[model samples]
Target: MFSCYYCNFCKNRKTTGPFTQIPNPKSVLILPKKKKKNRAAHQYHLHLSSVAAGRQPSPLRRPLSPASSVIGAHHRCVPVKLLLPPSPAFTTVVAFSAPAFSRRGPTSFQISALKPEEEAASVAKAQKLRALQTQFFSFHHNKIYTKEAVELSAKLLEINPESYTPWNYRKLAVEHYLSQPDCNPDSIKSVLDDELRVVENALRQNFKSYGAWHHRKWVISKGHSSIDNELRLLDKFQKADSRNFHAWNYRRFVAESMKRSEQDELKYTEDMIYKNFSNYSAWHNRSVLLSALFEKKAEGFLSKEKVLPEEYEFIHQAIFTDPDDQSGWFYHLWLLDQTVTTDSPLLASSWPAHGYDVLLVEERCYNVTVECGFNKNEDLLWKPLSASNSQTARVWVAHLKIPSSDLHSTVEVSVGHSKGIISTRGFEYSHPSMFSFKVHVQPMERDFSQVSVAESISLREENFMIYGTQSEESIINSFNQLSIKNGHESTASNWRSEALAKEIECFRELKIGKLTLARLLMACDVMSYPFANKLVHSEEVLELYSDLMKLDPTHYQYYKDEHSMVLLQKVTSSKESLLQHCFQYKDSVSSAICGPICLRLNNLSLSRMGAFEKLLWVQMLDLSDNELQSIEGLEAMQLISCLSLRNNKLRSLTALEPLRKLKLLRVLDISYNEIGDHSIDTTRYLCSSPLSHSVGSESNKDETVTSDVALIDNWEAFYIFKDFNLNQLDIVGNTIADEKFKSVLVKIVPKLKQLDGKLLG
Candidate 1:
C-alpha cells in the first residue's frame, strides 16, 4: 500500500525495498545529483520500484516498479517526477544536464547530439561559469558583508541601479545578511551605503519608474532618510515632472515621516489646494498630514503668522474653484470646527489651542454653531447660535493667547463635532447636529397650527425630561430637578380644578350637559377615588355641585339618589340612619345605573387618574368622542370596564396600563384616535398583562416549554392578539435575522405578542 502525493500521484510507486522485488523485477533508473551518493540513491530507486508494483510499502525502503517488466516490454523505467507534461519550464533545465545521460533518457524531446568536441567545449564553459558563481557566493556570503560584495554591488549600481530586482536583493543583502550572527554594524553601514548608491543608480537609470519612488519610500519607512539627501533626491523627480502627483505624494509622505515638518505638510496641502482645490483625496490626506504639523509647530507658526490649524483659504479655494464637490466643503467645515477646540473643562474654562469657528449649515439654510465633529455624539447636537453665521456658516473664534503649562489651570470649552453639510456651490458648513450644546435638547416640532412651534427645548429650561417610558431609571436626575423649579405639576392641577367646578355648574344649569367640567376634575383625582370624601369641606366646588343639583328635577333626583356611579360611587348601603341624595334618581337607578327615566354620568372625563381602584363602577356611558387627553383614567376603572372612547381626539395609550389589571371590564373600542407611530410601542405596554391582553392564556404555557417549538417562527414575528384561534402577528420589522434572534427573545419573555386587527374565535 502506497500513500498518494502531489494530487493523485503515488509517492513510492515502484517497489517495497532495495534488492527486493514483488512478483518479479527487472530494471530501475537511479538519479543521483552527486556521484558519491550513488549507493543511497540506488536504494531509494529500488524501494520506489517495489512500491510501483503495489508491494508492501516498507517505510525503511520503498522501491520503484519496472514499467517494462510489469507491461511485458522490458523497456527501462524513468524516475523523473514530471507531474505535468514537458513545458517551457522543464526545457529550461536541459541546459545543465550531462550529454551522455540526457541522450539516454526517455523524455528526450529536446536534444540528442553526441559530438565529443562540442561536449568538451560545453564542459569548459560550465567550469568557467561554475568558477564565477563560486566566486560570487564566496565574497557575498562568506566574509559577512565582505568588502568584495560591496565593491561589486557598487559597480552594479553604476550600471543599472533603478532595476527593482537588484535593489530589493541589495536590500536583503544589507538588512538580512548584515544582521545575521556575527555581522558587524560598521560593515552593515557599508552595505547600506552600497544600497543607497544602487538606488541612486536606478533613479539615474530611469527616474520615470514609480517602483523606484516606492522603493525610496520603503527605505524612508525604515528611518534611512536624511533631510538634505531626501530633498536633494526628491528634486530629481520634481525636475523631471512638476505635475507628478506621485512625486508630490512621496514628498508629502517623507515630510510627514521626518520630525522636520515646519510647514512642509501645510505647504504640500496648500500646493495641492492651489493646483486642484477639488481633489478630495489630496485634501483628506492633507488633513491627516496637517495634524502632525499642528502638533509640531504649535508655538511660532500660530503665534507669529497666525497660521490656523486648517486654513479656510486653502480648503475654501476648493469650494471656490468648483463649489460642487461636497467633499471639499466637508473638509472645510471639518477644519473650522477642529481648530481651537479643546476638551471640555469641568465647569468654567477657556477653549483649547484651536482658533477657528466651525458652523454646521443644514442644506445651507439653517446654520448651527458647531466645532468640527471629532466626538462620538457630534451629529445629535444643534450648533449654538452664538457661534454661527449664514455666510460660510463658520463659528466665530479668536485665537486665544494661551500657554501649554497653564493649559490645565483654566477650564476650556470642549471641541465637539457637528454634522457637516455641503451645498451645491461646494460651500461646506457644519450643521449644529446632535451635540451642539452643553445639554442635549431636541428641537421642538411644529405645532398643530403649523407654526414654527418646534419648541426650543433647552434642557436648562424644560419642565420634565422624559427619559423613557416605564424605565423610570432613564429619567435623568437633572430633568427631575428642573421640573421642580419649573412648577409644571402645580400648573396641571389648577386646570383640573377649573374643569371640575365648571362641570358641576353645567349640571345645575342643565345647559352645557355633563361635558361642562365636573368629569374632568374627577378624572384628575390622583388617588383614583370617585369624589371628595368630605364635599362639605371644599366650598366653591361644593356650591357649584349644589347649584347644579337644584337646576332640574331629573338632575336633582339623579344627584339626590346617586351613590353607586363608577366615577363617584362611594355608596355605603348601611341600615344606620342617614339618607342623603347628591344627584336625582327617578327609579332604581342604583340597579339599572340609568334606566332611561333616570340619568347617567355617561360623558365622564376619566383621564388624568394614574392609579386604579379595581371595581365595576359604571358602564354603557358614551365617554367616547371626548377630549380626554391621557390614558391615566383607565387605572381606576376596576369594575366599570366597558369603555367606548371611539371617534374622539385622544392621543395617548398611557391610560391602558392600569386597565390591564382589571379582571372584569371587557369590550374596549378606542378606534378613531390619532395614535401615530409612537402609539405602537405604547399599545404593547397596555395590553401586556394577563387581563389586559387580548389572548386567553392557559396555565400550562410557561416560558421554557414554548422557547423551542414556536419561537423559531415566532421571533421575527410577535403575536399580539390571540383570541381562541384568530392569531395576528407582526414579523416585518427590524433585523430579526434568522430564527436564532427570535429563539433567544422567546426565552426572555414567552408571552409577548403584537397583533394586527382581527376577531379571533
Candidate 2:
C-alpha cells in the first residue's frame, strides 16, 4: 500500500492504488463525525487504474485551497526545487507521497486528500490565492494595477506554477518595473535573479515546464544571471534524467547565448554519452557542435587528418558498446554525409611541350583560383584567364610557354582548395610567342574526403621511411595498404594481396575486439575498400553483410543492396562478364569505373527484370520490344532520365507507377502495347484501381463526368509518372481512343513536344 503526501505549494495530496485493492475511507465511516480542520469536504481519493485504461474521471469539487488542485499530469508536473526530485525520461514514477521525503527522494505522484486541522487553513489560503489571481487578471485586462498585479502573480504562481496566464502577467509586470526610471543596475539584477530562482523552482516541480524554461531564457537575455550557474543546473538536470528534451534544449540555448566553446559542449556530450550510450540527445548535441566547430574548415572538418581517425574511433566505440543503439548509427551516417571538397583536376591529360593553349577542367562550378608554377632555377606562378563558373562548361583556357632545351624542367599548376597538383615535363618550344601548349584536364569525380585523407597519409615520411623516399605512385600504394589494415603490418603487398590481407585482418579484429556495433562497422568499412579502390571481391564482405543483416534486421534491405553492388563490381573488368551479370542482377555499373553498357538486344528474349540498387548515375535505358510483362525491377533506377519500353507485352498502364521516383525522366516510349481497346470505357477501367485513383480525384465528379472530364483534366493522375515533364511519348500502335488518350496525356505532361513521332499541336 502507498501513502499520500501534500505539498505546501499545492495543498493536494496524491497517492495511486488500485480501486479494489486500497481501503475505501468512505465505506469505513459509519456517520458524520467532527469534520477534520485541515481536511476540506471537497477532497477525495482518486483511483489511477481507471485513468490508465483511458477513462475520464468524474469532475472534482472545488478544494479548500487553489493549491489543492494540480493543473497538469504528474508526468508533466514541473517539480519545485524544495519538493520531490525530478522524474526520469518522463516515465511513470512510483513513490509513497508521505511528508517524510528529502530533496533527493524517489519521485512519487498522487491525488491528494486534506486533514481536519488543515481544512480551515486551506480555506483561508484558497481565499488569499483567489484574491491574488483576481487582482492579477484585473491588471492584465485593465493595465492599471501594475505593482499589485506583479505581486499577485507571484503569489498565484507559487500555488499553480504551470499556469501560463499568471506567468505572462508577471512578465508584463517585470517589464514595467524595468522600464521605470527608479530601476538601477543592482535593482534590475536583483529582480532578474529573483525571477530566475522562481523559474528554477518551477522547473524543479516540472522539468518540462515550457513556460518556466521560456521565462528563464528571457531572464538570461536581460543579463542578470550567470550562464555558468545555468549550465551547471542544466548539467544536473540532464544527469538526473538524460533524455529531458527541454533541459537539453535549454542547455543549447545557454551555451549559444554565452558563446561557449564547442569543445566544452562536445566534452559534456561525450560525458553524457559515456554514462548512457543510448542517449540520442547527446548524439544530436554532438552533431550540432561538430557543424558549428567546423563551419569554416575549407576541406571540411572530417577531411582533416587528425580529426577523421579520432572521430571514427569515437563513433566506433559508441556503436561497439551498444550495437542496437540508433543514436550512434545516425551520428556515424552524419559523419559520412559531411561535404568533402570535390577533387577536380587542373589538367585532364599530359600536355606536349609547346606554346599552345592548355584546357583546364573543373569538376564543379564553384569559384576557385588556379595558379601555374614553373620550377626550374626558381618557381614562377601565373594565373590563367577567368573561366565561366558552370559545371556544364568543361573547358578553361590557359597560356603556356615551353622551351626546347628546357625539357628537364617541370611546369606545375595548383588547383584551388588544395585539391592537388597537376604538372607536366617542360615541352619543346621554338618561339615563346609562336608555340602554344595544349593541356587536357580530367576532373576526378569522387568525394574529396578520401582523396585528401589518402594524400595526407601518403605524405607522412616517418610512416613510410622503410620503403625509402619513393615516387608518387609508391606513396599512394603504401597509403592504400595502411588505410585498409586494421592494425600495423610488417610488409605490404600488391593490390589484390593487400585487399585479401586487410579482409583477414578485419576478421581477426572482429574476433579479438569483442563483437560490437563498431566491429560490424569496421568490418563493413574494411571489406568495402577492396571493391571501392581495387575491385577485389572477398568472402569477408558478403559474410559481414550477412552478419549485419542479422544484427540490424531493420536495415536488411540496405545490406542486400550493398552486397549486390560488391558482387557487380567484382566482374566489371570484363565487358562481356559485366553485361552478363548486369542482365542477371539488373543493376547499373558505377559511372566512376565504367559507363552503363547497353544490354538492349531484341534478339535476346527476356521475360523478367531483377531489382538492382546501386544505380544513382543511370540516366538512359532502352528495353523496347522485349517479352516484359511487369515493372517490378524498375524501383531502384531513381536516376533514369530516358526510358524506352515500346512494343512490349505490357497490358496495363498501372506498371508505370514505379517510374515516379525517376524525377529526371524526360522521354518514355510505350507504344504498340496491348494496353486497352479504343473504347471510352478504357478510361473507367484505368481509373478504377486505387493506384489509378491516387492520380486524380473522383470526389466532385459524377460517374459519366469522371470518365470524361475528370479523366481529361487529371489524366496524369493515373500513375506516379504524372509529375514527369515528358517531352516525347510513343503510344502509336495501342488501340485506345487515340485522340482522348493524347489529350489526357498532354494535360498530364504539359511539356509533351511529340506523340508517336507527331508534334502535339
Candidate 3:
C-alpha cells in the first residue's frame, strides 16, 4: 500500500492510492517554502512501491502530465490517473515526481497531534505541582522547619518565583535553622550562603521578580554576600535593563548599607544618564544625589553660584537632544522648587496704630510675646484670639498696661522677634484708655547683587540668544515696570528673573512644554526680586493653564485644578481683597462692632484653598460651587462659625476633620457633595477618655454606658461634633442623606436644632 498526499496549489485535485500505515506520522519532516510574487509554484512528492525480486522500474518517459516534471535520476513522471500500490510486506523507494499541488517552504509550520508521551508528562507535572503545594502548606501550618521542608519550599519556588508565601516560609526555615544550639558562625554562614544561592537562581529566572529580590535583600542583610559581589550583580542587571526600578532600588539599598559616598552615587547616575537621557530613574536619582551633594557642599561638585545654572544647562542639552523626553523637564522643575523661595511665614502687620491697651499681631507665629517699653520693657504673655486656641495662629492678641504719663512718650513694642517702634508723642495722655493704632512691618528685600556679576552677565547673554536682543530688552522693561508698580526696584540686573523670563520666552516660542512654562512663570512671579511686591505674572500663569487644557486635552482636569490653585493664590495674595471680602463692620449703640465677617467665595471653581492664615479672622465663610475634594487647609480658619461647602466634590465627611478644630463652628452646610456611606462608616476617631474601671452595681451601669459611648465615639464625625455646639447642619442631596443616616447624624451631633433646613424633633 502507498500513501498519497495532495498540495493546496491545485484548484481541484484528487488522488487515489492504498495508504501505507506508518508507525509515527510526526517523524516526517515537511519543509514548506514561502510564497513570493511572480514565482513558479511547484510541489514535490515521494513515491514508494514494492516489486518482485528481479523487477526493474519503467524508464523515464516524456511528461505524462503537461504540468508535471521529473528532476532527479531514477525519477519518472506518471499520469494523474495512474494508481500504484505497495506490497503489504516490503516497501521500496520508487521516484520523486511533481503533481498539481500548492507550494510550501521552510517558513511554514504544521500543528500535529500531541504525542501520548508528552500528554502523559504534562499530567504528571501537574500532579507533582499539586503534591508539592499540599506538602508545602502542611509544613507551614505544622511549623515543621526541617531540612526536608526547606527543600520542599525550594522546589516550589523553583516552579514559581512570584510565590511570596513560599519565599517567606523559606526565610523562616533558615532563621529557625540558624537559631539551633548546634549552629555556629560557620554553619550560619553556610546556611545563609545557600539561601543566597537559591535566590540568585530564582533571580536568574526573573531578574525583576519582587519575591526573589526581597529574599536576596534578606539574605544580604544577614551578612552572607559581599557588597562588591552584590554591586556587580546590580550592574549587570541595570546594564541589561536600565529602567528597571526594582534593580535600581535594590542598588540604592546596597549602597546605603555599604555607606557609599553620595558623590560616588551621583557620578554613577551621571554615567547612566549620559548613556540614556530618556531614563527617568537615572534622572530622578541624579536629582536626589545632586540635592544631597549640594546640601553637604561636597567636594568636586559645582559651587552654589554655579550649581543651578550648570544643572539647567545639562537639562537643556538633554531636552534639546530629544524634545519629547519628559524626564529632563521633571528634573528641571524639581531643581526650581528646591532653589526658589516662596511666601514663608513672616510678620506682615500689627494693629493699634499708636498707643493702645490691646495689641493685635497678624502673622503666622507659633508663639507671640509683646514687650512694651512704657514701664521699663516687660515681656507680656500673648494669647491667640482665634477660636481654635491653637498655639500657632495667624492673629495673636496681647494686652498692655499703659501708663498715663508715658502715653505721650516714645514706646517700643516687640512682637515675637520682630520689633516695631510706636510713636505715642502726639497721642493724648489718658490713663487706662484704649486707642487704635496700626503698624505695618515691611518684609526684608532680597539682595539680587548676591548673584555674582559674572553669572548675571552670562545669564543675560544666554537670554539674548534665546530671546533676541530686541525681545530680551522688552521683557526686561516689562518686568521693571511691574517691579516699579509693585513698589520694588528695577530688575535691570536681577539675574534670576532674567533667566526665568528667557526660559519662558524660549518655551513660548517653541510652543511646547505648556506646564513647564506655567511653572517657570509662577516661580518667577513668586521669587522675583523684592519679594514683598505683588506677584508679577499670576494672570499669565492662569492664561497659560487655560492654553494647556486646550493643547493637551487628555490632562484637562489636572490643568484645571492647577488653574484653580493659582487663582486662589492670586486672590489670597492681596490682603486688601481678603479684608474687603471677609470683614463686616457695623455701628453699635455704644461702640463699633467688627466681627463675624462673611466671606462669600462662591463659584470660583476652587479645587484647593491656600493661605488660610490670611482668612483666620473670617467667621462666616462660603466656599460653595467649587471643585474642592478636601478641606485640609480650613483648619487655620479657627474662628469660622458659619461655613458653606455646598455643591462641591467632597467625597466623604471625614475630609471635614479639619473643621473639627473650629470649636466655635455652629452652622455647617455640606450639601450636594459626593459623600458616601463607605467613607462615613470607615471614618475613625481616637477615644479621648482614658480606660478605667469602677467598683459596685452603679459602676456596672456606668461601665456599660461607657462602652456604648466608646462605640459611638469610634465614628470620626461623632467625635468632631461632640463639642461643636452646632445649632444647624445641612447635608441634603448626598448619598448618605437618607432617613437612617439622618438619625445617625442626630446621634453624632446631639446639639443639632435643625437638620437639612428642618427643625429636628
Best-matching candidate per lDDT = 3
Global CA lDDT computed for model 2 = 0.45
TM-score to native of every candidate shown: 0.28, 0.43, 0.62
Q: What lDDT does the true structure give each of the candidates?
A: 0.34, 0.45, 0.54
Residue-level lDDT tens digits of model 1 in 586-655: 2213321221111122234332221112111222223444444344334323333234455444433433
lDDT tens digits by residue: candidate 3, 22-46: 1111111112323443433334232
What is the TM-score ranking, best to worst? 3, 2, 1
Off by over 4 Å in 1: 1-174, 181-187, 193-215, 221-227, 236-253, 256-261, 264-297, 301-310, 313-318, 322-331, 339-342, 345-761
Give the higher-TM-score candidate: 2 or 3. 3
Model 3 TM-score? 0.62
Query: Which of candidates 1 and 3 is the stronger one according to lDDT?
Result: 3
RMSD of 3: 26.9
Highest TM-score scorer: 3
* Residue-level error in angstroms, candidate 1, position 198: 7.1
Q: Model 2 over residues 165-283: C-alpha lDDT tens digits?
A: 87786687778888999889898888888788788777777676767888888888877667788877987888788966568778889888988878888888888888888776677
